[model samples]
Target: MTNRRSFLKGLGALPASTMLASETGFAQGIERDHFSDIGVKPFINAAAAYSALGGRNMWPKVVEAMEYARERNVIMEELQDAVGKRLASLIGCEAAMVTGGATSSMTLGTAACITGTNEELIRQVPDLRGMKNEVIIQKSHRYSYDHGVRSAGVQLIEVETAEELERAIGDKTAMLFFFFLNDAKGQIKLREFAALGKKHGIPTLIDGSNSVPPLSRLSEYLDAGFDLAAFSGGKGLRGPYSSGMLLGRKDLIEAARLNNSPHADTVGRAMKVSKEELLGMLAAVEFSLSFDYSVENVRETRIVHLIADKLSVYKNITTKVSYPRTESGRPHLQIFWDKSLTPLTVEQAQKELEDGEPSIRTCYLALSDGELEVGAAMLKDDEVDMLVQRLGQVLAPRAG
Candidate 1:
């Protein structure tokens, strides 16, 4: 295992500017004591919390928000309620609530759908000894995160198509759940799914943790009639990585709150959000909405173009721009390579890049025809130059 402490030293000396920075600066000011004393070393955060990539770096604004909240204390419940109300207004939902993260929101939301605001039943979740424990989920929508819902103690009945989903709903079906990313795999769309739940008077829920890039995705499900929806705070939103939001119908959201934090003796109590995290996440939401995605794209395009311009000297390489789907506009980048001309494989190139001086973290995507895709999102100002230099050296004619 990599001794992360040693890695910090390898980044050379911490910059003087960092000396003045605060301890709660990691991932938007969550006050990471572990890293605060150690701080960030020099590694490209390409993996972006993919779990495989070790997640992403925190946004500075998020850190500031966390720090601001830490200074004073307020009633945690009141703070969450106020934040939820503000978030509801912002997202055009009937109500909203923050949770530990996207998964927490899912578990809590499912639990609420299972018990509503009933005190006795809420505490008896997952026991299901004598309750409506079934949750209707499409066969195609079963993803890793479904465990969160199932963790609430509901039995998940998998189905496909409108007919199957409708049939699955009954006295035991407490909620109909949808994983947004799997929309492509499912035959039913949000409107159809929501309608099925509505027809039966059952609540409909959606897990949209990674769906924010399109930007409008935030409002898409709400407008489509999902009774409850959850999204991540860390990734594109730049909030605390450990935080997320659950938003939807007022009564449902309220029920979710009663089942969750700032209180006790329920499933969501263990996954509480600190006042700092709550405020910081809200600030991140505001900042994310206010960001000029188009300008950010233009900036990305320039960096990618620069890298491509330098790499163009090599033969058998072609560079093309790639864009991420997002409401803020999307990330712009350049993809370089032509298999016939280069003797190296994409994996070999990736290894070479990761092994080079100053080290470079490039995003890789495999094509149907076997090509490597790279981007400019996580590169620092100096790292960009290092990237071009290393790629040039690695691709240059090698001696026998």
Candidate 2:
């Protein structure tokens, strides 16, 4: 889970009035909205799972669970135990801990892997002056999010080859970290990486944050023998945006929790996973696990086909429907346009969609490869029509 720091307006500290603004303050009221009075109306999400597009929507059950947890007040420690145990069971892990978000989990998980449940070490995080604080990561696995590991006070050692990775692991090597999104770039595969970590007696952690939605991936890392893994509760899971889960060996997860909520002075003190978000995450996990993938695929395919057919007449454009897998478990549609026909670049098309009657978000990937790819996983029943209509508007003939 990513640590969501509330925006402090002018003074470093938020005024009490600002914090008490509205239930929807987290979702809207920025100065950029041209749709309606910024605070009074909701903005349409056309950008798909971008954090700026409000990440992902919470499942209705998650919202209800949050409300249920909010209405009652209990000792937070007990709440943590129950929520953690249930979450661990649902994810098929020995234990689990909810943090501010996936990045918080990454930071706390890294700290716990290095420092264990030691109180002295827990308080000295992001500054391991006299501890084993080196983490081995593939050079290809480097990303902006790796800052989470650094935030834990660990130094990242970049390795590209299997031999380099092996040599990089030493007594000071606290963790072997892998970013699931960069699996294609890394030389170490999951099973091989896990084996290497086991051989060296080092902890292995895989950041599977945006890699969810396919469901089986919930257990895939564990099954692959990873010692610890972090996932975004908000992304594919459709839980609260502020919640995320750290799943791993019982000891490590417990240590992670020790450094998290219901406790202060630890590195993760400020990264609290509220009781409401915890409950909502549990409900979201249950709902996601219970969903039928095959049936969902059929529906997703029908939607993809409908969009593909609707735009088939435009000879200048080309559309091929394919099942693309994201961090989320299920496969969704990837719609790409032929860039050769007209000068309507991907960016222009995206902006056009965004500026339309109902703003729509589409995927944008910049690769040396030919055209741009847009995934359809984030679209809803009504948004599907909106997408088709908007595409037609942009691709139609120009007036003389």
Predicted model with the maximum lDDT: 2
* Model 1 residue pairs with clashes: 27-58, 28-62, 28-63, 29-63, 47-53, 49-55, 139-159, 213-326, 214-327, 215-327
lDDT of 1 at 188: 90
Report, for every candidate in turn, its global Cα lDDT versus the true structure: 0.72, 0.73
How far does residue 109 in candidate 1 sit from its true spot (Å)?
A: 1.1
Worst ten in a row by lDDT for model 1: 1-10
List RMSD in Å for every model shown.
Answer: 9.4, 9.7
Off by over 4 Å in 2: 1-47, 327-341, 367-372, 397-400
Summing lDDT over every window of 10 consecutive residues in candidate 2, give the lowest-scoring window: 2-11
The deviation in Å at residue 80 for candidate 2 is: 1.1
Error of 1 at 279 (Å): 0.6
Tens-digit lDDT string for candidate 2 (278-323): 7898888876665544554555567777777877776655676544
For model 1, how does the per-residue alpha-carbon lDDT over 188-286 read when each residue is reduced to its tens digit? Answer: 977889888888899989998877654456677877878888988776676787888998888888888888866687888899899988998888776
Off by over 4 Å in 1: 1-41, 46-61, 213-215, 324-329, 332-352, 364-371, 392-400
